[model samples]
Target: MRKPQQTPAQATTPYIDALLGYRTRGMVAFHTPGHKLGKGAPPIMREVFGAALLAVDVAMAGGVEDTRESTGLVRRAEDLAAAAWGGERCFFLVNGSTSGIHSLLLGLAGPGDGVILPRNAHKSVQAALIFSGAVPHYVEPTIDPLWGIPLNVPAERVAAAVAAHPESKAVFVVSPSSNGVCAALDAIAGVAHQGGLPLVVDQAWGPHLRFCSRLPLDAMSAGADAMVTSVHKLISGLTQSSAIVARGERLGLQRLESVVKMTQSTSPQALIYASIDAARAQMATQGEQLWSRAVDNAEWLRARLAPLEGVRVLSDEVLGQDGVADLDRTRVTVSAAGLGVTGYELETALRDDYGIAVEAADPLNVLLNVTYGDSHDDVALFAAAMTDLAARRRGARPLHGAALPANWPRFTRQVMTPRDAFFARSEAVPVEHTAGRVSAEMVAPYPPGIPIVAPGEEISDEIAAYLSEAAARAMHVHGPEDLTLKTLRVVS
Candidate 1:
């Protein structure tokens, strides 16, 4: 893997430096953030976050850069991030990748316009469709029967969708899915461009891909017209920090910027912006070394766990399967089905017994995110915990069920546009009666956050049954009026 070199400008943290300078100036009584530099902060807040953090938790207007006018420091930081990520322009996001996704969809599509996107996209995409009033042409992603998890959407499928819906304003897809399965983005981008549509990637988990050559190709390098990354997911940035990087070839930057600003909070946090800037600088300079270490740590943990009885570590074996063109090695997925335990049970055991919490756990697999922040000691502890768990569960009968039901329903037919159904009068109906009814809310499993039933979609018997089974398994259901799954909201 080639090591990345950052120019002097790329290595500078202009936003962070400016924030620190502002804090050092010791201006009396901040205009907003009633904390007054930690003095007015609650005792518990001061104790938990410390005075230094509160001191710099300043507003965007008078504290860092005036939102009304240009100070150029924040712009410089965003420009450097754009250069680092190989995008024509970049916008730092304080509201996370959700805002970025919203901006992308709203900016690219108008009311009643069509957008082709994978079925396994995040709930934010559905929310964006509702906000933009865009009609969705859903593309089913390849599902791995072994794991019952949704994989990448094939380029051919995208091409077919584009051919079918020639009126689509843009093609959006999620690369390196929540399960670490990456799409053939280069091919997909080509297909979208050939159809005269810009390709937008929801790369929320892959902000580090651009900096590390060892990782899968980033969206920008894969010819995506636009992409959003959550800098905090696998990098050093704080939570809710993200970046929207876009090339203005097809989607105008002015429109994107306007939509982004509209979706974003006017009272944006300075710390989040500074963290994004700092993260970009750090990744541009030392990403190769840091991510190399993280990859090594993940591999070492995988190797250590491979020999454990009944534990299967997923690695490069998933590549070339379905639409998975590459794998993110840092996401270590361990299947504990052979140990006669559900992933939730294994997760509970690890958290309760070993005090180790993984990223997310489904029925058969627990996802462990190993990043630059992890050390050899951390991986060793995890390996040791897995070894102990394996030993304790040895010779147990293997679990016989798949992660998802064999007859799991695909995306149901759209009875109404998401926006129309969302705004239409709706009422709650029994789960069993939901079949054949147009859904007024999204119902999705929480870990992966892909909706099984989106607003305006006709709920089928298979989908209702699958959702009932999922609820019985105690999986967290998101975006529904009733979390118990007893009643579902449908168009009246």
Candidate 2:
């Protein structure tokens, strides 16, 4: 007997359609609106930007969903998200995770305060340092020798950082790095709370984690004071959708909201707002069923790729003692180590040659982010492509004659505040000659996207070499240096 195929009724289309038609009962706006729906915006508001933007800017005149104080649709959406993730409060974000991150940091820190951050963090956090005028102390995460990826910072590092900076305001971490390496969040939170500091985590790729047990624990459950998640990264929301999920009152929601308002657009897109509302509703309604499909698809892909030569799938082998909580199976991280080509090369070939776009391309690994939208057949196609790629690059010479270094130049020495150096008087000079000057921009490797030389750090000769070698291998680096590393931007 043949197994029954899944039905289309189980499709996410119905829920998505419902969200598309979501209605806010507010007035159509007429005073400021030329069409005159009779709402509360300036007369020029519609003319300055466009009618479409202001058309959706209706207030909760009668029965419309209110967003400011949250009564109808907004409250419902947030309640749905809160219940889905076990968070007490979940607020939608108009801008990307950048806005959410800045808000969280400002809520917890201020001038003269110090924050503990992982050395390998998004440049946005460093930017937050300038906005809030908070000093930052660094913590380096563990390196996985076999895969050549940076794992999560251990709990001990957070503890050490907090202890060293006794006045630290918050413990910040990125769980399940962009490469899919997770940290022990529970322990990290314990350390933060013990030190009387709230824990702030950036879990941008983990919106689906709450629905599935196979994934690692999300920031909210780990007792983090607040977390910022980008739904566009992995969830089914539009490209710029994100949210700030709080686990407690320590983060000061009022202050966070003010910051969010300041950074976000006054005339928010109803389309984006509706999408978030629908995403929240979907998760609230059938998260388990959808998330299970995504997980199963990823696992099926992992199993198929295991038989290929030079293709290694990380299991417990990649995770160290108390190093990671659980692997996000959805993010399929395949190390191209010993496969004769850098992940950057594979990424280009995959997209250009095979028409497959990977989530990220790095020197050692390619990250393929799977989501609820993809099916088992999609993963099958990816696995087949990898099989061919493995065969093609086997005899290719490495970009660097020597194998990847067993160790990287340690991230030592912080000379100035990242914020000051970024906005200060700076010059663009040759990379080779930029050794002593403080960097004025970020030079980050792709897969991790963490800055080795951020705006305020002094670049080392060893750090420069790792990047040049990586570029030779076709790795795409972002920020000041143009991947070639011929020139770097620096503070004059």
Candidate 3:
């Protein structure tokens, strides 16, 4: 007879068991935690977290330590996660996927090394570049002129970038953008491996992809060397909890572990670890059913909104574009341009008037995320609110002025690496006068967090005009001390 297969509960939650076992043992107070597992803490403090939570708030040493020879339960939990996500190794991240991205960069590439990435990457990718002192070879993502949104980067771009920068250490890509548009990761990964490089994917918004058949291919399944995903984004984990999964020998596990540990807190929270493990268990056991309901709920809402004149709910047809291979239907992105309102105005109205919180917004579209936790009732309420707003917009003029420039400003020159410029002598200058100067800091528009200006980039007239226009339109621009765009930081 064949050996019995282990159940989901048996495979996952090893760390949870270890934590709970130690919590239930009722051992003497821990050594480090000043609270000593709620005993030394004030009654109110204990009351705040409640007995059950405080009970498991033990240190990593006494309670959870198994042995040096045998890999601990935390390692087991990570192993289970690796198996669940289809990776060779999985590491639990308590500092969020930001840390994982940093780890991937720091581990694979270092000072003077090149890492090819897309221009529409998250700010964390830039931070990782700075941390690793790696030079970035930026590829432009496909831009949708009609919607004013960046779609996926094509695989040919990745291949061409790799060919151009044959000495580059790794290729990095982000899939299922915040608004749910996805790249062709399998093709991209094949391109990277063909050029003798590892692919590092920042799948921070795609934690549920592996579990849902309807979702796009996850980084692991696509044969990425390494991938970082934020568990809290779509999976039911604590906010800071994430996982970085890796495969193959192209990238060393030791280096990845070092960078991860260096960035992570020495005193990692047991609660966060437990939550991640529990989330893995939940995903392993019941994710398909949960995602089915979520997709149904999203479709229900989209169907209701599609008939409304003012709102145009984006469908999977957008995936048929040249670069976009797939679209995550869970993101109910509805364009408000036809409604004669800015996405910002629509977001404000939804929150203030209807008490509905959306995920994000750009000038044209407001994004609503449907997750396992969402219900049909929740969708019904949001649909009704949107319907009311559509009815109220009886040919009102768009509150916004002009659509953003079709093409964003491209860096004409790189004065220095991001690390060097960030650390070099810097001074603040009037934004208008800094057009020709190399920037010492990043300047990004908030709604779509891509950086219009990054360290070491030569700022251009087009960039200045775009930023000024964004500010004039009351868009929240981040990374600049002067919110009004009057001044900018530049390398002297």
Candidate 4:
């Protein structure tokens, strides 16, 4: 894909320049952040964070611009970001994509409103349902038999869901899942618009998609009404940096901005804002070159690992299967099931033996994310580590009891709205006895963070047993009050 020509204005980082200017003025501190320009900071903090970083951690009010009046520096930066991402409006998020999801849900739907979304959505979407009292109409994503991972939701399923729930306020979906399987966004968006509903995408993992044509189509270009992307995920932004970009008239812009203000912090972190601003400029001017290199490195690693004994690296073979329209080359997903070891075992071996950590690992696959930040040397090191592990484990017997149960529940039966169950009086019950009861909490394996059982769902016996198995494997369970799964929170 040819790189888009960047305008001169895209090169300007207004908010970052303003923040740097403020840091250099040497103004006396009299407001919040008692650290007071690193003077009062402890020696340990100063040593680790350096003086320059500490000095620039200033408040938005009076530091970046006037508190009461609008200087439009931040607004101008957001304009560049929106244009770069093919959105009409963009709002920077300091609390990450989690907050962006919240704002999107709250802005679009109120209590009792129905939202059509995929069952494989991130846990943050479930949280949004709990916060907004929205009713979820789940569209189950196609499960890939080879990797035992959830793929994209088919457009037909979405259209069927929309038809079934005509009163639904909006439609939401996740594209380019954590493992890099992208949904057919254009077809899905067409169905969504034909149903007269706005398409909101949780594109937290595909922030760099718009910059590189080798990647899947971005949300805005696919005709989504609104979408959120985490700049920190696959880009040069600081941690917790994200942006909510929207286009088209289907969504109310004023309400969206109001909800963003409500969900975001009153005193947002200036550093995160500056990083978002600067990252946008970088991607706008140099993203094609940067992501192209990342894609090359990732493909090289995949090619090197594919020939190794008992190892399978996912590539173009996955395309045209399930609902996967395109693949992100920067994400190298490796399955070691043939090596007689689980992905968890492979991840641990790589980390402990080679001092190499991957982005995420499931029972069948380890997802390695290659970004502009990684060099060819970094990719080579990971490839070497994986090759060594595969060679040592060749001809070994398959690990018994390493796989999750085939009957492991993906989406449980929803008995009530998430908000109703979450806010209702609840009690703790033993995991074994909790089957057939209404769950008052959410439980999911971290990294992918898709809930196996969410609030208001009726806990089935199969789900209960799966939780026990997940716990036994020491999978980092997220969102449940009882991390051990010994007890589950259920509605009274």
Instruction: Give the residue spans of candidate 1 off by over 4 A.
Output: 1-5, 402-408
TM for every model, in the order presented, reads 0.97, 0.84, 0.93, 0.97
- By summed lDDT, the worst window of 10 consecutive residues in model 4 runs over 399-408
Q: What does candidate 1's lDDT look like per residue over 361-392, in tens digits?
A: 88788899999999999999999998988889
Ten contiguous residues minimizing lDDT sum, candidate 1: 401-410
RMSD of every prediction: 1.5, 6.5, 3.3, 1.5
Residue 55 Cα positional deviation in candidate 3, in Å, after optimal superposition: 2.7
Candidate 2 local Cα displacement, residue 154, angstroms? 0.5
What ranges in model 4 sit over 4 Å off?
1-4, 67-69, 404-408
Q: Write candidate 3's Cα lDDT for 272-330 as tens digits.
A: 88888889888877777798899899988888988988688878778778678898999
Q: Of the candidates numbered 1 and 2, which has the greater lDDT value? A: 1
Q: What ranges in model 2 sit over 4 Å off?
A: 1-72, 392-408, 467-475, 481-485
Better candidate number, 2 or 4, judged by lDDT: 4
Error of 3 at 421 (Å): 1.3
The sequence of per-residue lDDT tens digits that candidate 2 reaches over residues 1-492 is 111122223233322242333334334333322344423446686568575544544333322334456445665566556556666677777787878888888777887688999886776787788788777798987777666677779898889898899888889999878877788899999999999888888998787777565667777777888888887787777778888887666667667667877777765554566566667656645666787788899888989888887777766666664467667878888766667666666777889878898887666667888888898878988988888887887775544434444255568567777777778888878766777678877777654667777777877888767656654554456777466767777888
> Which pairs of residues collide in candidate 4?
none
